[model samples]
Target chain A: MKQWMTLLNKELLEMTRNFKWIWVPIVFILIAVMEPITAYYMPQIIDSLGDLPDGAVIELPVPSAEEVLVASLSQYNTLGLLVIILSSMGIIAGERKSGVAGLILVKPVSYTAFVTAKWAGAMLLLWISYFIGYFVSWYYVGILFDTIPFIDFIQSFFIYGLWLSFVLTITVFFNSFLKSPGAVGFLSFAAVIVLIVISGTFSKWFEWSPAQLLSYASTFIMSGPISSDVWAAIILSVSGIIMLLGGSIAIFRRKELA
Target chain B: MSVVHVKNLKKNYQKHEVIKGIDFELMDKKCIALLGANGAGKTTTLQMLSGLMKPTNGEILFSGSREGDDFRHLIGYLPQHPVFYDWMTGREFLEYAGKLSGLSKKDSKKRTQELLELVGIEEAKNRRIGKYSGGMKQRLGIAQAIIHRPKLVILDEPVSALDPFGRREVLELMGRLKKETAILFSTHILNDAEEVCDEILFLHNGRLVESGTMEQLRDKHQQAKIDLEFKEDAARYADLFTALVKVQSHAIKRNKISFFVEDIELAKIGFLKVIAERNLPLVKFEISRTSLEEVFMKVVEK
Candidate 1:
């Protein structure tokens, strides 16, 4: 436990030194704030562009707070996920490539501790950035549209957070063996995209898939109630994260740090 | 007492075996040089001993520990090229290493400071490792390797990548470090093996071809040899020296010839008579014992 904490501190320090703490949250906030602002001013933006015919009456329906929040999540699902994946793709692979893994692994430290510390550090960053982005989007939704209930908002936030955690866990797992950060990011993103596509196309079959957590989150926010499948999806995603972490440690132990 | 004992240790990567069943023991409080040419499995052996790599077959017994026991805490290792977190300062990196080695917070900090001073990098303790010079980085590497005060420290070609000044600094530091804990370092440089090591383990083609105390190995393999340097072309004299009846073997390079002799006295007399009679352009002639380089070459060739 002590060793894990020490390694965790080191990982956090690395993140801070890399300015991940500053820029990641800044990007998240910017993406989140853009959602409601764009939705609220679409007519004005379109009017200022003068692309329509002269004196043409434009009928644009105002989106609800829930719809705005969902739109923000969809934006995060693309751009936000890309940023998170890119930032963390190098966490394990870079250390191994740089030969730092050999230096640390030679000590009495357990592989489990080393891997868990990395996961925890990435999760911490994810939570901070996700919450800040979600809450800021919620605040903008309240100003532009109707206010969402706090209970429903928090529940939706956690379910979406589970999806982010699952993505990061996959990144860490691939990073354990892959040498190139770009390859890890590309493969992991491809995996996530496939999961999202499968879940959307075959919702009846993948209702309990971990990928459904995002849809469940958006559903909970828009309707204030989730089906039994949401609970199943949460359980699956959480277990998947744990298994990925364990698999990373197991593979890392057998890997030759050359 | 031996700190580490290996019996027929072997590591095979697929069909090609890197370590072909080599065995040696590391004695307490002694510095052992693992001498080998490149591609000779020195790093592979060190990695297996440090628990970074697993041996395919054979046993590594740590002192007072069973076969399956975890002995990593009792050993410290420095790779050939030690990489660090560039964002971390020297002090923070050492502290992190110390903590990883099971040192407590206070103990880690204290040892970190002491090691910074011991390795002669106290002034750069707060400087990030990215800004450090090669010598300072090596010093920090050495400092981190011994921060836990393990029973044994393994260094893989510790000075092979450094400049002369940096090499001298690390060698001198290794001299001091051996007093506190046993050290097993691998180097291709025979002079480095001779300068600080008490014992030498020479590896060739994945086998322990020769190993003994520096004096013991020298005495065991020592041969009477003569070195002759000519002012003009020495190849001109190579044929005459090779024809001498007492000359067992001869190696020539540029303007110098080293002749290994069956009988030093007879060979010296005949060579001197030829030099006097012919008045060859001789610049230097000396009789001396065989050097470690010759022994290494002879062993590797065999």
Candidate 2:
């Protein structure tokens, strides 16, 4: 038990020192503050296009509460993906470069412990960032509209963070196998694109695609009722989390620390 | 009792055998220096002994057993090119290494400070390792290796990267470690080996060509040397000296005539008689003892 803690501590300390711990929270906060603020003011900026020409009845569609939720979520989700990739990119890939892996592998700790600790620590940091961002989003949206409640805001953002966790887990798994962070990041993004395209083509497989997980998150925040499809998406996201984490540990164990 | 015992050890990377069937024993608390040219299987041997790599055949016994897990508790290793996280301080690096060696948090902290002081890096202990000079980094590497008081420590070319002053300091630290642990290090620098090692294990062409105490190895290759400086026209007396023939071999270098002889006392006696017979001029005449450097070069070549 002590040995495992030592190994876990080493992993966490490494993450703290290497800029992972600090940047995740900063980026997530930026997303949180920027999301609702952008949503609240997007209308005025669009309307300031000035008076239309005489007889040119160009009527702009009214921005509703649904539009506010969707626009804010879209912006937040982009930053959320960035935080996920940035934090998970160096989990194992950096260890291989720094020769830190050599020091830990000689001890009694198994490869299982090494990978599991890396994933768990990274997940913890990501979750913390997501929560902070969610709180900021709720507060900022409330400042914009007095009627937005905190509990409803959390419920909407929780599913988005969970969906992002699945994507982050995949990034962590690829990080273990790939030689460079650039390669892992690029490959993971490419794989996500392919999955999105396939889901769009096959209606039956939409629930399994991680894209649905993200899309349904925005649907919930717009005050739309959670459907059977949303639950299915949640179940698929959980399954993905398991496969990614399990595959990472297995591949990492077989890899010889060169 | 031997601290390390390797029997029929073999390691292969696919088709090529890096470490062939090799066997050796290291005695307790003695500094053993491993000398081999690059690609002579020195690194591979150290890796297996430290449990960083498993042997493909045979066994490595620590305290008379092949238990890999507990065996590492008694072994500390420093690789030729060690890697460290760029952002961590020297103290953090050693503390982490100490913890991995099963030291408690308080003990790890205490030992980290002690080792930093021992290696003369106490002032730089809190600085990030990435910002350190190569010599400072090497000192940190040594500190971590000895932090846990391992019984057997293996360092691979530990001083090869340091400057002359840094080399001297590290070599001195290693000399001190000789009293506390059975130190085994590999280096191509013959002088470092001569200065710090009690026994030298000469590996050549993937085989143990010679292994013994420095004096023992020197004695095995001992040949008396006679250095004669001529007062007047030494070149003129070269033919005459070679012809007298008590010398095994003689090389003329400017004003000095260096002769390899079978017996120093016999050569002295013969030299005195020849000087009297020829009434030759003599500036200096002395017999030289064989140095460890000469023995190392000769044995390694064979």
Candidate 3:
């Protein structure tokens, strides 16, 4: 347990020194805050599109606060996912490449503790960054449009957080065995893309899939009381994360350091 | 006391064998050097002993420990090129290493300071490792390895990357450290292996070709010799020395003539007397112990 914390501290320290603590959240907040601001100013932006042929009358409907907020959240579906993956891609693999893993693994520390510490570190950053950007988005939605369902807002917060966690976990999972950070990112991005595409294509079948959790996140923003299928997707996503972490620890132990 | 006993250790990566069935014992509080050419499997053997890599077939028995025991805490390892997180301060990296080695929080901090001072990097403890020079980084690497004060400390080519001054600093530090703990280091530079190492193990082409104390290796492999310089090309006066003394053999190379003899004391006296009696112009005459390079050559050449 102590070894895990020491590693966790080291992991966070690396991110902090590189200003990852600042940029990762800023990226998420920008993606989160952009949708609401753009939606609120669309009419004026269109009007000011340089002499719009007098009475071009672009009849654009104003989206509801919940809709605008979900739009902001949807931005995370792609951009936020990428940010998480890209930021986390090198956490494990970089250590191995630079030979730091050899130093750390040679100690009395267990592989489970090492991998868990890394996962927990990334998860902490993910949660804090996601929460801060998300809170800012909520504040924006309240000011620009009607306030979103308060309780529903909280539920979707976790659902989306889990989805992002799913993405980060996948990246960390691949990094444990693979040596190249680029390859890890590519394979993880491919995995998430596959899930998104398959679930988007076969909604009825993949409703219990982890990808369904992302749609479920937006659903929680729109309404209350989710169906059993959404619950199934939630369980699957959580299980997938646990399994990935568990498998990463196992594979990490079997892999040689030098 | 033997710190660790390795028996018939062998490692194979698929079809290619790396360490072929070698046996050796590491004694407590002694410095041993693993001398080898690059690709002689020095690194592989050290890795296996450090528990970083498993031997495909062999037994590594730590003193008083059985199979399935968790003895990693008792071994400290520094790789050839240690990579530290650039952002971490010298003190932070050492403290982290200590904690990972199972030291308590208070103990880890205290040990970190002690190691920083011992490695002579205390003044730069606050500085990030990224800012350290090659020598300082190596000192830090050595510090981290012995943080837990393990029974055995394994270093792979500790000074091979440093400049001349850095190498001297590290070698001097190793000279101090050997008094407290057992150090097993690998180096291709025979001088390094000779300077600080009390025992030497030579790995040549994936086998334990030779290993012994410095004196034992020197006596067994080397024939004491006398070198003569006559101010001019000594090779021109080869016959004058051969007739003066019945050496086992005589050879001329460059400006000096060498008499290879089993008995260096008698050979030295005879050569000196012949030079004085003949009124020969002798600029230098000296009896020399065989260099580790010579012993290393004899072992690896085979």
Candidate 4:
């Protein structure tokens, strides 16, 4: 336990020194605030473009605050997910390639502790960045449109957080076996995209897949009290995170550090 | 007492074996040099011993226990090229290493401080490793390797990459380290092996070709040779020297010829007779024992 904490502290310090703490949250907040502000001023932005005929009657309906928040999530799903993947792609693969893993593994430290600390550190960064971004989106949505219920905001925040965790878990798992961080990022992104596509296309059949968490989060914002399907999705996603983490540790133990 | 014992250790990547089956024992409080040329499985052997690489087949017993034992706690290892988190200060890196070796917070800090001083890097303790010179990084590497005070510290070519000054500094440090704990260091440099090692293990083509104390190895491979340097026309004497029955083998470079002789006395008499008859312009002539470099080259070539 003590060794694990020591490694965890080291990982966190590495993150801080790399300025992940500063840049990641800043990027998240920028994306979150931009989504709602842009949605509210879409007509003005279009008018300023000046390509439309004079006195053109644009009859686009004002989107609800829930809709704006959901739009913000989609924005995060693309740009935010990209940021998370790019930042974390090197966590394990880079360490192994740089030979730092050999230095640490030679000590009395367990492979499980080393891997778990990395996962926890990545998860910590994900949680902090995602929550702060979500809150920023919430604040802007309330100002530009109707205020979302506090209970509804909290529920969606957790469900969305689960989706991010699932992605980060995949990043860590692939990083354990892959030598190149670029390949790890590519494969992880492909896997998540495939999951989202499959769950979307085969919704009835794959309703319990962790991929449903994204929709579950969106649904919680659009309405309230998600169905039993959401509970099943949450359980599946959490178990998936655990299984991936366990698999990472197993693979890392057997890996040969050159 | 032996701190580590290995029996028939082997490592294979796919069907290609890198480390053929070999065995050796490391005694407590002694320094052993693992001598091998590049690609001779020196690093592979060290990695397996350090628990960084799994041996394809073998038993590595630490203090007579092998089954279900965490022997890593009793061993510290420094790789050929030690990598560190560039963002970490020397002190922080040592603290991390100490903690990983199972030291408590206070104990780790104390040991980190002591090790910084011991490795002569106390002034650079707070500097980030990225900003450190190669020597400072190497000093820090040595400091981290011994922070836990393990029974045996394994250093893989510890000074192979350093400049002369850095090499001397680390060599001197290794001399002091052997007094506290057993050290098993690998190097291709024979002089390094001779300078500080109590026991030498010569590895060639993944096998333990020779191993003994300095005196034992010296006595075992001892051969008499005569070095002759001519002021001019040394090449003229080379053919004549090669034709002599007493000369077993000879190496010639520039104006000098080194003759490894079957009978030193006969070769000396024959050479003196040739010098008088041919009126060779000899600048220097001396008879001496063969060096470890010759022995190593002969062994590896075999």
For candidate 3, what is the lDDT?
Answer: 0.88
lDDT-wise, the better of 1 and 3 is 1
Pitting candidate 2 against candidate 4, the one with the higher DockQ is 4
Provide per-model DockQ scores. Answer: 0.78, 0.43, 0.81, 0.81
Which rank order by lDDT, best down to worst?
1, 4, 3, 2
What are the clashing pairs of model 1?
none
RMSD over all Cα atoms, model 3: 1.9
Candidate 1 per-residue C-alpha lDDT over B63-118 given as tens digits, one digit per residue, 9 for 90 to 100:
99999888988998888888999999999999999999988999999999889888
Show the colliding residue pairs in model 3: none
Please give, as one word, the docking class of candidate 1: medium
Residue-by-residue lDDT tens digits, candidate 2, B52-130: 7778898888875555545767878788888777788898888888887878999999999889889999999888888
Instruction: Summarize candidate 2's per-residue lDDT along A32-96 as a digit string, tens digits.
Output: 67756755666676567767565655445545544555566666556677667766787788777
TM-score for each of the candidates = 0.95, 0.87, 0.95, 0.95
Q: Count backbone overlaps in model 1.
A: 0
Q: Which of candidates 1 and 2 is the stronger one according to lDDT?
A: 1
Which of the numbered candidates is closest to the native, going by highest lDDT? 1
Candidate 2 docking class: acceptable
Q: Candidate 1 residues A1-258, lDDT tens each? A: 999999999989899999999999999999988999999999999899997887899999988888999999888888988988998999999898888988988888888998899989999998999899889999989988889998888988999889988999999999988988889999999999999999989999999988788788888888856689888898899899999999999998888776
Across all candidates, the chain A TM-score values are 0.97, 0.85, 0.97, 0.97
